[model samples]
Target: MSLDVVVVGAGAMGAATAWQAAKLGADVTLLDRGQVCGGTSAHGVGLVTRLLWEPPDIGLVAHSLDRFRELDETAGASFDYHDTGSLLIVGPEHEDEVQKVFRTWRAQAIDVRPVSPGDVAEIPGCADLELAKAEHAFFTEADGWCVTMDAVRAMVDEARSHGANVRPNTPVDRVRDGLVRLADGDELEAEAVVVAAGVRSRQLIEDGWRPPIDAFRAQAAVLGHEGNRSGPIVHDTPNRTYWRPEGSGQVMIGDGTDLSSHEPGLEPSVDEAFAHRVAERLRDRWPAADPIHEVRSWADLEAATPDARPLVGRVPDRERVYLCTGGNGFGFMRSPALGEGLAQRIVQKGSPVPLHGCEPSRFEEGYGTGFPMQEGFALD
Candidate 1:
């Protein structure tokens, strides 16, 4: 059967895209090289915060937060959504930066407000944060976290219910124009071919266009606490570490992010020293989580573009080829919005206003060389 859309890479971005496209009545085929949603997002800290600078980024996250809330209520697609909010703790040294971020959020009318050091201690699992020394702190009410793998599975299940053909562990050999050649020699034709395959999306685009995305590694660990009082995500600005309550008696910690080049498909390695460092910080910041040790650690190759934002929508001059990758470290939070917008474009029913700045063709020749890679969660 001819499919209206063939989505490659069934991570959050691709799964969300396929689900929405299929829901909109498009005959969709979602393909993945491995398990759906078991990509970088599965290895993430699952923190969804509203700390953004660009209007497009801020707008998309607002859309995503709304969508996450909407989907949580829908059958077969619950994201295990949490509305625990987020707390940002800035040490005295980085007070300027946090102030700027707070102002940016306020300017956008984001639901954020200042929190005193004492207030930070009140949150569960945050009792012993050297309350007197904390310089700047704020809490964004809308931020939260989720379980990615379960969420993606639920979304794909919903897509299947809508008649989309979902093929897991089906590697796509090649993509061009409107045709996709599978690794096993199967061919599928679709009106639009969307590549949301993380860093690997570069391999598909390199033959026809220069990829502006760079792959780098981000490491994180799960620490087991004594109790189940883990929920809200806390970001410490000076250390660049962020963590939140995970499952019962467990919390997730992330910070060991670097821009150093890392190839995709390679087994990712977590720096042991880095893990210890974050654990030390956790011990100092939140005494309640003290004695919390690393229960597990993981690393994922995160992609970043020159401008620290994802590239979405159709590639200029490349008819039938649309891209949904280049997450720039904000992929999971914005996946639903990206999926919705791209699906609308594929179905030919969108002006795609939010994606105008993220168009793949916006980068001209040699665009990748001059621009330095931006840190994933850096506010500016």
Candidate 2:
């Protein structure tokens, strides 16, 4: 039987898209050149939360959290879904702006509140920090992190149970005229195609039809700590750093938005300097904590668009071909909403969530350059 939909790239977005399409009764096939969740998803820190500054992002994350709960409950999956919450730490200089953002978030009905520096130490995992040096912090009760690989595996399993064909180590050379051409010269025709292939999505499309997406290298490191206290995910906006607990006495730290051009599909090398810098930052933030030691470090490529928003609609002038690239480094957190929205656009002719800002046609005129990394996370 002919397939109704063929999804390329079995990362978070593609896997979720395949599952949603198959659940809607479409014959779906999910193809990946490597193992599932073996791309950028594997490198992700798995910080899933709804505490975003932008209205659109807030809506997307809120939707994703709901879907995540439903999937965990009904799909019999364990994503290590935690509601340990998140803290947007800011210094005195950004107090006013953060307060404004906090009010806006509260107006949106998000369970967020502002915590003054005087009381910041009351939060667990934050007691060791130099609270007196900080100005304000926005705390959210519902935001937390999850294990990305576990979520991907669960979704793929559910998709397969729903009759979606999953093929790993199956590379597609290119896509044209509603046909997927394999590297080995085999061709498969489908009623529709969804491109969620991360940075490689550009290569699969015709030259002129490629979106303005580029690959950038990002790095993170895990560290060993002394205490077993699980702390809230903390974003030190002023320092351009973020860290979170990784189990009992372990933690992970990363440079915030340190992006550089990189070749697509190449394994990234860890920067020793960056790893050391992360360790130093941890010490600076919490002087009283046990000395941190680097456990391991990794690097990966994340897709970035001219605008920070993802492209999540039908490709302009491409018949039955859709693009869902440019995750902007938060693909795992936003995958559920993106996948469901894309599927709705294909099968139901409308999305349950608003995708106007993320429409692929936004780049028709010309792609913008230089998106400020700090804007998406409310650092600005």
Best by TM-score: 2
Clash pairs, model 1 backbone: none
TM-score of 1: 0.91
- How well is each residue in 1-380 modelled by candidate 1, as lDDT tens digits? 43489999988889889998998889999999888786886776766777765667777888888777776777443557888888877767767766776777887789898878768766665666665555777877688888777667777887898999998899988888888888899988888999998888877753557558778888888888665775478887666788888778887888845677776667678776877888887777767666777788888888788877787888766788889988876688888888888888778568453675778877875555334667757643
Residue 61 in candidate 2 has what lDDT?
A: 86
lDDT of each: 0.78, 0.80
The candidate that wins on lDDT is 2
lDDT tens digits by residue: candidate 2, 1-380: 43489999999999888888888778999999999988888778888776766778878888888877777776663565777889887888877766776777888898887788777788876887765545667788788877788888778887898899999999999987688999999988888899999989878986446677777777888988766768798887766777788977788777745666666768778876887888878777777656778889998888888667898888877887898778877778889888988888787777777776998888864453344332244355
- What TM-score fits each model? 0.91, 0.94
The C-alpha local distance difference test score for the whole of candidate 2 amounts to 0.80
Candidate 1: stretches off by over 4 Å: 1-3, 76-78, 92-97, 100-103, 131-134, 351-353, 366-371
lDDT of 1 at 378: 60
Least accurate 10 contiguous residues by lDDT in model 2: 368-377
